[model samples]
Target: MNPVSQSRQSAIFGKRKEPHTVIIARGDQIRHFTVRPWIAAVAGSALAAVAVGYLLATSYLVLRDDLIGATVARQARMQQAYEDRISSLRAQVDRITSRQLLDQQMMEEKVGELISRQQELAARQAKIGPLLDSAADLKTSSDETIPTPAPRPDVRAGLDATTHSTLAGFLPDLRAGSANLSAADNADRLFVSINQSLRSIEADQMDRLKSMTEKAYRTADAISNALEGAGLSIAKGYGTSSVGGPLVPLDQSMQFDAVVDELDEALTALDTVKEKARQLPISNPAPGKQVSSTFGVRKDPLLGTPALHAGMDFRATTGSSVRASGAGTVVTAGWNGGYGRMVEIDHGKGLTTRYAHMSKILVAVGDKIEAGDIVGRVGSTGRSTGPHLHYEVRRDGKPLNPLTFIKAGKAIAGLI
Candidate 1:
C-alpha cells in the first residue's frame, strides 16, 4: 500500500487506537475485563481530589494550634503588664495615703501647741492683767515709790476686752476680708497668725517678768544693805522648807506667780528686819563727844597695871547730859560696886547697855527710855579718875566693844 493511502485509512478506520485489558483471579476462579482511557483518567482525578483535601485539613489543624499558642502567650504578657501596672499604682496610692496622714498629724500637733499656749497666756493675763492696769494708772515719777491699786469690777472683763485689740492691729482678720485663697489655706494662715500672737504675748510676759525680777532684786539688796549697816540680821525664807503632797506640775504662769510671791516675802522680811534693827542698841550714846579711853585691855591709870577695860569712855564736862543709845527700859538705876551711879537699860534680845561713872542718874528702875533721851550726867565717880561718860554694851552678859556699836550706828546714821 502507498504511504499516503495508508495514513488516510488509519485516520478513518481508527487503526491507531489500542485495546486496554484487565484480569482478576480469586483462588481458582478467574475473570476478564476491558478498560477505557477516559474511565482511568476519571478515577485518577477522584484520587487526586481526596489527597488535596487531606493536605488542606492537616495544614488547617497545624496553623490553628500555632495561632492559639501565639494568642495565649500574647495575652499572658499583656496580663503581666497590667498586673505590674496595678501593683505600682497600689504602691503609689499607699505612699500618698501615708503622706497625707503624716501631714494631718503634724497639723494637729501644731494646733494643740497653739491651744496650749493660748491657755497659758490667758491664765497669766487673768492673774496679772488687773495689777498691771492698776500699776499703770497709779504710776509715779520715782521708781522707788509704790503705787496704790485701783478697784475694779473684775480683772477678767478688761483682759477679755483688750486681749485681741493689738492682734487686730497687727494681724488683721484673715477671714473678714475678701481673699483669693481656698478656705483651707486661709484657715492655715489664720492658725499661723494666732501662733505668732501667742509667742509675742509670751515674749512680753518674759520681759515684764525680767524687769520685775531686777527691780525686786534691787529693792531686796537695798534693804539688806540697810539692815546690815545697822548690825541686824534677816530671817531666812522658804528655800529650806519641804512639803509632803502630790507633786503638781507648775506651768510658766504658776512659776511667775511663785517668783512674785517669793519676792514679796523677801521684801516683807526686809521691812521687818529693818524695824527690828531700829530697836537694837546700835546708836551713839554721847554724840560729838571726844573719846578718852577705848574698850580693851589697857594699863590702869590708878593701879599702874594692865587691866581689862570693858567700856568706852567719852570725855565730857561734868554734869553733861548722857543719852540713851537706843529705845529700851531701864533695868537698874542705882549705885554699883565700882561704877558709882550707874544705869542699865535692857534693849531686849538678850542685849543691854550700861551708863557708869555718872554724876547723876536720871533714869529710874523700870523707866522707859528712848534714843537720845537723857539717862544720866557725865561725872568723875567711883573708880573714874576724871570727868567722863562710861558706855558699855553687852550681849548675853558678855561684853562687846562699844566702838563696834558706834561704827554700826554711824553706818546707818540717816536710815531708820
Candidate 2:
C-alpha cells in the first residue's frame, strides 16, 4: 500500500494507531499530552460529577434560608393551635364550674324552705294534740257508732314519693362519689330529702287534724244528746244573752284553714250545749241524801192524806248542805209557810228550781249562783217529821219530774 493511503487507513480503521496527543509550543519549548480512551472517559465522568455537585451546592445555599423560615412558621402555627385549644378547654371548664356553683346555691335555698315548712307542721301538730285529748275525756255513751273519716291519698304521692325514693337510692352512690362529687350534687340531694320529709309531715298533720275534728264533733254530739235527754231543745233561743267577736284573719293553707274552722265550730257547739245544760235543773241539790218520798201522787206524811207531791223529799240530817240544782240568780231566799228557809232560783229560759225545808238560808235575792252551790242547810222545820230537803224542778211555773234532770246531769258532768 502507498504510505499516504496507509496513513489515512490507519487514521480511520488500522490497528497500529498512534496515541492521541495534544501539543503546545512556545519559543522552542513544547509539551505533548496523550490520553487513553478509558482515561478520557473517566475524566469526562469526573467533570460531570463535579458539575452536578456544584449545581446541588448552589441550590442548597439558595433554598436553605427559605426552608428554615417555612419550618419555623409551621412550628409556630402548630404551637398557636395547641394554645388556642387549651384556652377553649379552660373556658369550658370555667363555665361548668360556675353553673355548678349556681345550682348549689339554688338547692340550698330550697332546703331552707322545706325546713321552714316542716317546722310549721310540727307546731300545728303540737297544738292539735291537746285539743284531741280534751275531746276524748268527755263522757257520753251511745249505741250509735261514730263514723270514721274516709281514707285520704297521702300528700307524699307522685312527685314527693318519687323524690323520696330517688334520694334514698342515691344515698349510697353519693357516699361512694363523695370524693369526686361537687357541692352542687350534695346540695341537690339534701334539698330532695328535706322536701320529702316536709311532705310526710304535712300528711301526718292532715290525718291528725281529721282525727281532732272527729273527736270534737263526737264530743259536741254527746253534749247535744245529753241536753235533749233533759227535756230541753238546743234550737230554742237563749234568753237575754249576747256574745260576738270579730273574725281574725289567718294566713294559712286552704286545707289547714278548713280543719281549723271545723274544730272551732265543734268547740262552739260544745260550749252552747254546756251552757244549755247549766240552765236546766239537772244538778243534784243534796248529793248524800236518799229519797224519802218521790214526786207525784203519794200519801202525805204530815197530814196522812192522799195528795200530789210536787217535789221529791231527800232524807238528810239537820244542817246538811242544800245546794242549788242549776246556775241561776236567786229570786227567793227566806222562810215560807210550808217550806221553812226555802230558796228559789230563777234560771234563764223560763226554768226554776226550789230548795225547801232548809234550816238556814245562805244565799239572798239577786245573788248569782252556779250549780252545786251551797245555798242553804236542810231541816224539817215545817210540816216535816225528820230532817229532809224538798227539791222541785219547774218550767214556766209548771212542775216537772226531777229524776230526768238528775240523770241528764250525770251524763253531762264528764264533758264539762
Best by lDDT: 2
- Superposition TM-score, candidate 2 onto the true structure: 0.69
Q: Candidate 2, residues 159-237: lDDT per residue as tens digits? A: 3224433443434554455556555565466556556656665666566566656666676677667778778766633
List the pairs of residues colliding in candidate 2.
Answer: none
In model 1, residue pairs whose N, Cα or C atoms come closer than 3 Å (at least 3 residues apart or on different chains), thus clashing, are: none
Best by TM-score: 2
Q: Please give me the total number of clashing residue pairs in predicted model 2.
A: 0
Those runs of model 1 whose alpha carbons end farther than 4 Å from true positions after fitting are 1-141, 145-260, 413-416
lDDT of each: 0.71, 0.74
Worst 10 residues of 2 by lDDT: 143-152
Please give the lDDT score at residue 416 for candidate 1: 44
lDDT of candidate 1 at residue 300, scale 0 to 100: 97
